[model samples]
Target: MKNALSRGLLLSTAIVGSLSLYSLTTKVAVVTADADNAGLKLPAGFGALVVAETGARARHLAVTPQGNIYVKLNRPNKEGKGILVLHEGPTGKATITGGFGSYGGTGVYANAGYLYATSDEEVFRYKLNSKGEVTNPTQPEKIVTGLINRHQHESKSITLDKEGNIYVNIGAYSNSCQVKDRQKGSLGMPNCPILDSAGGIWQFRADKLNQTYGTGTRYATGLRNVVGLDWNSQTNQLYVMQHGRDQLHDIFPELYDTKQSAELPAECLYALKKGDNAGWPYMYYDNTQHKRMMAPEYGGDGKKVSPGNYIEPAAAYPAHTAPNALLFYTGTMFPEKYRNGAFIAFHGSWNRAPEPQKGYYVVFQPFKDGKPSGDWEVFADNFAGSSEKVATGRADHKPCGLAQGADGSLYVSDDKKGTIYRIVYNKK
Candidate 1:
């Protein structure tokens, strides 16, 4: 009786409101993951399965309301295609249905009857039909172009809000805006010219076309780089994860040891406002001290505190974790504990040498009343395949992108292997 009731619920309503018990049998439901869970360590009652494997460098992803998957490749495939569309099959695997666009970087998003994507230097959008298929697969309107991409930390991740505005990340070209970037004993350039065109987030009209880099409003400044950002509808605000600058010890040996360099500046989660300044190049958030500290490139010892009243991070995580994706959980599939919280996919680190490189997994941060509620905890792990691999900085799969399906399942993409893993909550 328990098995029968669980397998078939009538869910009666206005004839079209909910599914009849028999109607669900024909649906393309996601099957349960294997006993091994495809090599992921998720929380209890959660399971994950391999969805699809694109042979390109899948960076970020978007899923349409109808469950179609759009994956952005970091580089164009041999066929010069950048966006790969996949359709879920009956047995829970995904099939590549089609692809579009010719250039690539990061930032693929589906919203408001269009599919938006980005290259390192431009943003494009394609019209979509009611069925969620791209009407113009090859001919996308160039929304914004000529963005500053100096090839250092230059992936243009993007997100959109309800107000018809699109936000883009233009990463800094220099590690610390130094006169001789990353060189020992180098001083920061006056005023950090990089902040003018790069090192910040910009807001632009989502519907406009052919807009150049100068046309967009500089939404916020002083961020070195942000790969994962999301517009939190629950809070009606924008949030971003900034990648802290690197090589502190190599540049200022007297001020920092290698272990300190690897773990000094914290990867920050910033709840942003229109004119917010996060104080990059000039300062970094030291998680251990939980205070903003002056950067060594700007002539400060490690202990000097920043004087400016810049915005402090909403939350902080370990440095060099390389947070690559941020998603505010608004879906209903997970338990109430996850509602309105944030899930960040850390791509892991290469610079945490002598300290055991870490962070090839996903983490969950609780939220309450539009602010972070408590400490973050590791929600998923073992993408490195073993403890030995993470200790040696050899992660087999680096989770890069995240998307939520119509059914509220979470999809994570791996850039290293281009594997997409779909995580679902199922308990017997």
Candidate 2:
């Protein structure tokens, strides 16, 4: 009888020892980083690693608390998969384990035990099991449908507020709401017909099924395009980064020189309220002038002040930078200054011809009392790979999406080469 008891005790001890070894191995792998910081230039004490090479047009991504990463591709792969699932292994790098969702779009969000994703004209949700694995990837419930997709600015970017509401951006098809749409010397369409269905944000129930435009409420208007948005828990408000219109000098050479065109209308960050209008077709925020100037197509030249009724931007950045993702930090891993502040990923600029194209990096905007406090600073750079590449407007990787890990690490996605980078601060 004594020998039997001794044998059982030894078996239990062996099992416990094996588990300890496994746990230690996983901890070491999770904290490790690539030696070169994955060719990214981050702030002091911050390092980066290549999470995975998804090999698709990874537009946006969501990281589960369990470390599972879901990346949304801009288009479906040859296998008809638009979502790639990455699971980090004992090697400190993530491996593409699975993929699902046969359609493509630009947005992906994980909240309330569900994975919400968007196509060009629809939003869908899939239930995630306790392990953060999507249980019904092959059959997702449609939350929204019949959205406008003009093939230009057609990506439907989405975000969810805590109150079970989702907001989707429907971009205006017209460059400046001109009657002829990007044609030089064309006047702006009177009252802008696109405003009735596009060029705005619509709010709908996050959990609802098959909700269309008739069921949703137009939450905001006059936004030319918005690809990045997040719900600010610090202020209980929705914040969005707007991509300002293009072709200032090309269409209106008499009013704007190439230098002015390169730097005229600033990409804007807006804190939204219901019915807020940011004045797209009529006006644009000028960071240099610190004022909203009436759009040339509408009636006034570049110098004319805009109407006071138009909602002003909370902050503005260099024009044509193409702000693609907005994330408000709420983690303690970074310094106290980063808490509740915002990170914006600029996907580089193409409209700054004759001058060097700029802004293929991430910027940190400080926040005080739930509003922007001081000047924004570059947080991560060199995604373009070289200064010559930035000068020639040829970026190797454009930062398009931002996500925060369970450990407060920041993740940025590049659609060009389908690379995912994870940024961590002050690692041991």
Candidate 3:
């Protein structure tokens, strides 16, 4: 009888010992960078590292509390996987541990014990374990499905507020809601039928299961396309960067010159509330004039002003900058000046031809008390490799996504090069 009891005690001891070893092996290391940030250019005392060169086209990413990084790919990998889970090693390198989600997508976020991601037509979420890894990677719950994915501007970038609501950008398929889209002589459609289902931000319950388009509410309207958006916890409101309508001079040469087209309508940043409309198709904010001008399709020349009631943009940028990701910094690792400021990833422009393509960098917009306190400045540059590449619109890496790590480091994803860069600040 004594031998039997001794055998059971030894077995339990062996099992516990095995678990301890396993935990040590699985423990993730905190990532840090060298004094000089690899190759990326930044301000003094800031550094970055090309932590992972993910071969997949990384779109948007989310970092968990445990430093686990999940990236949503714009295209499936060679193995037909669309999402990648990365584990950081003690040496500050990250390795792709698992890849799943067959459908390719652009939006990925982690919140409320779930990792929320989006395909062009649906929004899905995976339950996260205590270690911040996906508990069920193979099968995620479809939170929202059957969205309008018409192939043009269909990427559904998403963000969740502190409340239970999740916002998704449903970009308009048509550039200007024209009667004959993109045609030179096309007129703007009256009442703009696309606004009924698209061209806006939609809000849905984050924790709800299997919601359809009918189950969501249109939070804001008249946005042509919004790839960059975030919920600012400081302001307790939603902010979005709208991709202004394109082909201003191509289709309306008589109204606008090539130089004017390249820089006329401003890419706008808007702080939004429910039921807010920024007036697309009818009017566009002119950064030069600092006023909302009537669009050519709406029967207006370049000099004509619109009488339509449209909310003014909180800030405006050069046309076709293509802000793809918006992040409000709330971390203490950076200096106090960075708090509540916004970092925007400009994916670069292709439409500003014959002048010079611009915006292959990230910019910082200062904010105080939820409003723009000062001018925006280029935070990171040289993503295009050289000035010639910027002029010709040839970019080595176009920044697509922005994420904040638990350690207050910034992560930027480049879809063109499938690279992930981690930016950190060290006081001099």
Reference-based TM-score of each model:
0.94, 0.93, 0.92
428 in model 3: Cα distance from truth in Å?
5.4
Q: Write the per-residue lDDT of candidate 1 for residues 1-428, one digit (tens) a residue.
A: 00111112212223212222123443324456756888999999888888888977899999876658999999888878888999876446789998888887999999979999999999999998977789998788999999988899989999999999999999999999999988999999988999999999999999999888668999999999999999999889999999998888989999999989989799999999999999989999999999999999887799999888699899999999999999998876677888899999999998778789999999999999889999899998998999999889898999999988655578999999999998877753
| Candidate-wise lDDT, in order | 0.87, 0.87, 0.86
Candidate 3 per-residue lDDT, tens place, 83-167, comes to 9889865544688898989989899999969999999989998999878889888888999998898988899999999988999
TM-score for candidate 2, residues paired by index: 0.93
- Candidate 1 residue runs with Cα over 4 Å from true position: 1-28
Q: What CA root-mean-square deviation does each model show from the true structure? A: 3.3, 6.9, 8.4
Comparison by TM-score, 1 against 2, better one = 1
> Worst 10-residue stretch by lDDT in candidate 1?
1-10
Candidate 2: segments with Cα more than 4 A from true spot: 1-29
lDDT of 3 at 94: 85
Query: What are the per-residue Cα lDDT tens digits for candidate 2 across 178-288?
Result: 989888889898898999999989999999999999999999999999999999998999999999999889899999999999987899999999999999899988898
lDDT of 2: 0.87
Cα shift from native, residue 82, model 3 (Å): 1.0
| Candidates 2 and 3 compared by TM-score, better number | 2
